[model samples]
Every structure is written in C-alpha cells, then in structure tokens.
Target: MQRILEPGQIEALASRSVPRLRLPDRSRVFAARAERLGALSRGHALQGYLELLATLAAAQHAALQSLEVTLPNESRRAAARHHGMPVIPALGEARSSAWRGVLDALRTAVAAGNYPPAVAAACERLATRSAEALDAQADRLLAVEVAVGDAAAAPLIMAALQVYWVAMAARLVADDVGVPESSGVCPVCGTLPVASIVRTGAPYAGYRYLHCALCATEWHRVRIECTQCSATTGVAYHSIEGGSAAIRAESCDSCHGYRKIFYQEHDPAVDAVADDVASIALDLLLTEAGFHRASGNPLLWQSPG
Candidate 1:
C-alpha cells in the first residue's frame, strides 16, 4: 500500500504558506460558454435541470474561488457521483432511448423552470429505471457524455466534482484498506491521474500526490520515482516560457510518461482542470519532448478533424 497525506495535512500546508496565491475569476466566461452550450444541447441528454445544476455548480465554484473556500475532500465528492447515479435503463435486449429521454426531461426542467415537483419525481424514477437497464459500456458512455456536457456548460463545477470524487475515493482506500503500489491510477474508479503534484509542507512535505483525472483525488506516491514505471532514472522537469512558475510538466525518460504540476504556491486559485485547459502551450512543449501524457482531458482534444 502507498502512503498519502491525510486531508488535514494538506489543509495545514495551505494554511501555512506565506503570501498564499489568489485565484482568478472566470465566471463570466464560464457562464457565457455554459449558456451557449445549453442552447446547443437543447435536444441532447444534458438539457434541463441537470444542465441548470451544472451551471449553478460552475457559478458557485467561481464564487468559492473568489472567497478562497477550501474545496470539499475528494472522497465526499466521489460518493456524490455514485449517489446522483446516472439514469441508465435496464439491459435492453434492445437499445433503449430511455437515457435520451431522461436527458431531455432534465433539459426541460432546467430551461422551462415550470417543471413541478411531480415532474422531478417522474424524471428521477425514469433515471433510476434506465440505469438499472443499461450495460457497463452504456453506463460508461453515458458517464462520459454527462461529464462532457457538464464541462461544456459548467467547466468549474465539473472540475470541482471531478476533484471531489477522486479525493473521496482515495480517502476510502487509504484510510480503510491502504494505498496500492500504483496509486497512479484511481483506486476507486480505475482511471488515470491528471497529474502528480509535489506537495510542500509538514507531516508530508515534498511528498508526491497523484491527482486523479476522473474524480480529482490526490493519492500519495513516493518521491524520486517514475509514476509510470516506478523507475528512479532520468526524471526531469520541463516548462514553457513564462508559464514555468505557474505550471511545469514532470517527465520520466524511463517510461516516456509525463505529468503536469501546478504550483499552488504561485497561484492558490489554480484549479488543476481549469488552469490545465488554459495552459495548452505547456502540453505542446511536453509533447514535443517525447513524453506522452498518461491521463486525458477532453477539452484539450476538441480540435476539428
């Protein structure tokens, strides 16, 4: 099992830093993008109430950034994902449009604002039924779509949820069972981490935390080794001009894998997901260095084919 800093440990580090970094306010951009996406996604599965929740979550996150609220732990957030539960219908020996219908209802609820309590009740019932019917493949696809839709309309909210989910999962494993050798992958959801952070401060200063891509959990990994191959050889840091202080890509020559590191010291408001999306230049530079990313970001790859 790998070792990780408890949630309290991380908070202590955040509290002690002199001249703590300030985050940015991108709420306007997020709101504008979300509104445009809501319009485009009118007929899609992410319409209505779900879309509204996503938008509100994004706005709230932006506000939280401005207020410097320490975000919820990852484990608690992950639980919510499972709790909210995707509305998949049962194993349809036939393809079910139930999922689509549920999305439509959610959209309707968000846009119309006239959906009664009965309507919400009906939608919830349908969502539960669909989830039971859908296969794992369908479920995963739905999860991706839901995430993408939410991100398009509410990037900050989606990002925060992602982080919360991972943290919750990590807390479960680390506190209950113990950390695995490859904390590189999210133990709870079996997804790759977005980056490996070199955290500073007491009880675990200079420790490595593998940040989850899906749930945003940060699990402890040992320092001075490659997360991909567990190799201790030829690990290096590369960064783009001017962006070096804010973000850097940690490359492992042995495994040909690289992860981005966000220096919270330099910018407290730096969200791993939002800032990562904004720093494509750094990714380009890391890619040019022959290091491939172990994790994936949908927004970073939305270029037209």
Candidate 2:
C-alpha cells in the first residue's frame, strides 16, 4: 500500500528547502523602491505623496552607498541564537550618532532633486533640528510610539535609519542569525514587517516572506495563516474591485488584523513596501470593514488624532 499525505503535511515538506531568510541587496533595494514609487505615482490619487517618497527613497540609495556599519560580535550572535532572538534587535541596540550623518546625506541628496516647495521646506526643517531632538524622534518611531512622533518627519527619519540597518544586515552573514521564537517580527532586527510578499522566480517562487519594515529582511512564513496571531482559520483576502490584481489585504477574523500581501506572479515588479503604500485605498476599505492594520508602513506615519 502507498502512503498518502495531507496537503498541509506536503506543504511542510516542500517548504523545508525554501530559504528561511533573504537579506536585502543593499545596493538595489532602495533603488528598486524608488523606481516602483515613481511608477506608482504616475497617475495615482496620492501622486504627490508617492513622488515625495520616491525622492526620499532615491536619497536613501545615495546615502547607503557611502554608509558603513559594524555588526554585532560573536558573543551577541551566540546569545541571540541561543535565545531565539534577533541578532541585532532594533529596539534594544544602542545607536550611535552616525545615523544623524546618514540623515544629513539624505538631506543633501534630496536637495539636489527638484521637489515641491513644501517638501523641500520639510527637508530643510528636519536638517535644522537638534541632534538630541532627532534621536528622541527616532526612539519614538522605532518603538512604534506613534502618538509622540512627528508624523511629517517620520519618513525621513526612517529613511536614514533604514540605511544604517540595511548596511549592517547586508554585510552580516545570514548563517549567523536564527529565527526568533515570536515568528512575526524580523529575525535580524526584531521589527514588525511592513508587508508580506509572495515572490516569483528561482529559489523563492511562490514562497511567501514577510518584508521587515526596518532592516528589510525577508523571512519565510506559510500562506493563508494570520501573520499576527498565527491563526489558520477564518483567513480571507480582500482587494479593491478595480485595483491592481497583484495586491490584496489578508484579514484574519481571529486577530481582526490585516496586512497587505503582494503576489509577484500577478505583477512581477511588485515591491512589498512600495505597493503597500501605493494601495492605500485597500487599507481604507479594510478599516471601514473593522479590520485594523497589523503594522504601519515604514514610509507613512499617521498622527494621533
């Protein structure tokens, strides 16, 4: 007699070969994001804002070229591996003043581009803020203390922070890190994912990975499960009637939380972060239906009302 396997069991067996984590290519991550943002802005309702983010992403790419960061030592890596925690926990890591220099690089790069007066003014104002104030703002943002952060300045601060972290993550050997027990947060930096992507192509074809909002790490997770609570039941996907076929909101009745998931098969160029922001309408619709977002977009911050 031949043995039979359940679909779930077969899936588990097949998933074993999928790479657990795919670190960002520091050289092209921001550039790809900028290109996607630029494409999304062409005829978008939020064209101006998307374009602004494109400019910021371009700056991030520029800043990243000259950025250098030191990774955690062997002791730290061993400790994190033993405890199933992030190798360089974003919230726990001690930051240096070097990030402020990344911010300056971003400001300089953005200044070279032609932008709206208001946008340029925001960049100028951000540049003039004291180092202490900038550090405080970054702490609030990194901790996801949304209410206390200046919403207008969060994106720029996040851009600089991303450059710093991406530099470290890009340089570190993936073998040095291990998945966290929590499963939902980034294994490299322990930050919430900005969005999840079902990628196309070799090695990762049809594989789903959560795109980290901070360090830009990609970690595999099974599909049709709640990314927040790990619930497998009552999971459904929602999308705008006339929106891009590539994107959808995966809402879980168990957690009542939703995160956008992009299918690269539907659109090969889809970017987890770029498309997440570009499809704000789906978020609004899901919110109206009582499904709250599982995490905030790294490029967009909302002020507390």
Candidate 3:
C-alpha cells in the first residue's frame, strides 16, 4: 500500500519565490505524469489502459517539444475583453491554414506514440476540423463531464489542442488583456475544471488553484469553497484506505459534485492530471455516496451505460 502523508505535515515544507501555475512547462509535465502513471499502473484494475495512456502521454510530450504556437497579442485580448469570448479561436473562426499546423503536429504525435490505426485515423479527422468546428464540438462535449465518454477520439483531440493552446497562451497572454475570472468554469477557455492543485515549494506553497485539463491553466479558488457549487457549507474530503497523502477527493453536498485535489507539499511528485487519473478508487467511492465528477479528465473516456 502507498503511504499517505498528513496534511499538516505538508505545510512544513519551505516556500518558493512565487506562486506556481501549470501551463508553461507542458512537455516536462507530460513526461513526468506519464512516468508516474506507469508506476501507478503496476497493481491496478486499469493497468492496461493506464499503461497505454502513459505511452500516449509520452508521445504528446515528445510532440510538444517540436511544436510552437504563437497567438497574436491582439487576438488574445479580443477574446479576453468579453465574458462570452473564447480564449482561443474555434473552428471556422480561424482559417484552415492556421489549423493545418496543429493537425500536422497532432498526427505526428499520434504516429510517434504508436497509437493504433483507429486512433491515428481519429487524429486525422480531428486535424481536418476547422478551429471553429473543434471549438464548437469541444464546447458541447465539455459542457457535461459524461459527454467525453461518447467520443473515442476525445482524449487525443483534447491532448493535441491542450498542447497547442497552452503553448500559445503561455506566450501570448502575458502581453494581452487578462482573462476574466469565472467562479466555476475556467477563465481562460470557459471549460469546467478537472481538479484543484495545492501547490508545493516556497512562496507558492499551500496556495490552491483550479486546474483546467483542456488548456493546462490554473486559476485561484479559495480552498474552503466548493469547486462545484461555490458553496461554503457541506464541503467534505475523502481519501482511500492507504493511498499516498499526496491526493484525495473534495466533494460538495450542495451540488453533489466531486473533484480531486492534489496536495503537493507532502508528496512533491503529485500532479493534478496524472494523480487524478490514478485515484480511480476515490471516484468510485464518491459516486457510491451520490457525488459525481464536476469536470472530466481529457485522457479518460467512459462508455455510456
């Protein structure tokens, strides 16, 4: 069994120079998460699938190394100044020529990762989609956590766009208009959050931020507030019998929604995405109690019953 660290023990760790966000170093994160997922798969019900995901994540990391996206400062601000504006251009909103590059990069990532022919083909289909089309489709799918399970290509498509958008956003947002804050959905992309992060290292230590799986951005949300319903009451936390102290689920009674939180101080190895995926037992237990996930991990797909 994995050792769980106590929360108080985590606070004792030193601080960092500044608060941290997860978007900038996309490749390193992907690589480390893949490694961690491989380790986590050693003895689990989802071992085969987890292992496959790790391989795919590694491929994404490699693909990210070579892909460069630069969003114009003007375009970024145009989207940010309005509440309804999307952070990145969607299908038809951007020209086909612009999307071709991302599609090419995704195809390479899929092929390099050695995904099956079906997955490769799926990537190709995603590649051909105009930014407007992808934006529309993803917006619909992300509206409900359960919707992702219906599309086999969902994971691949999300991963590819995540890399592309994060890369450009990291560089562009700094010089553009600031993203407006949203209580539940991501300020950057209007997507629901996948999980919250309890940061590690110095000055950033212990600060909490909600992590977006689609674009890798982190936005601040108070630790005490319910991520699902923004409720201050009836929020609860749960952990497995003997899992690492690094991860757990935060559930809200007000909306019956649950989200994973990664407290990285006690276990610096924790990641919002990888750790969330590895903690399937917590999801099952939470659901058994009537809570449901408010957000979806792009790497996971569920089949509708």
Question: Best by lDDT, which number?
Answer: 2
Query: Over 4 Å off in model 2, which ranges?
Result: 1-14, 111-114
Model 1 residue 270 lDDT?
46
Quantify all predictions' global Cα lDDT against the true fold. 0.47, 0.87, 0.68
Better of 1 and 2 by lDDT: 2
- RMSD versus native structure for model 2: 2.1
Which residue runs of candidate 1 sit more than 4 Å off their true CA positions? 1-174, 201-204, 298-305
Instruction: Write out the backbone clash pairs for model 2.
Output: none
The 10-residue segment with the lowest total lDDT in model 3: 90-99
State in Å the error of residue 172, model 3. 3.3
Q: Candidate 1 residues 126-228, lDDT tens each?
A: 3454334333434433244433321222222233333233223333333232223344555444456666655565544555566555544455666566777
lDDT of 2 by residue, 1-305 (tens): 99999987997798789888899898899999999999999989999889878888988998889887877788988888888888877886646788999999887777777777866787888888999899988988999884755676688898899888898889877788876788799999999998899998988998899999998999999999999999999999999998788999999999899999999999988988889988999999999999999999878877766
Which candidate leads in TM-score?
Answer: 2
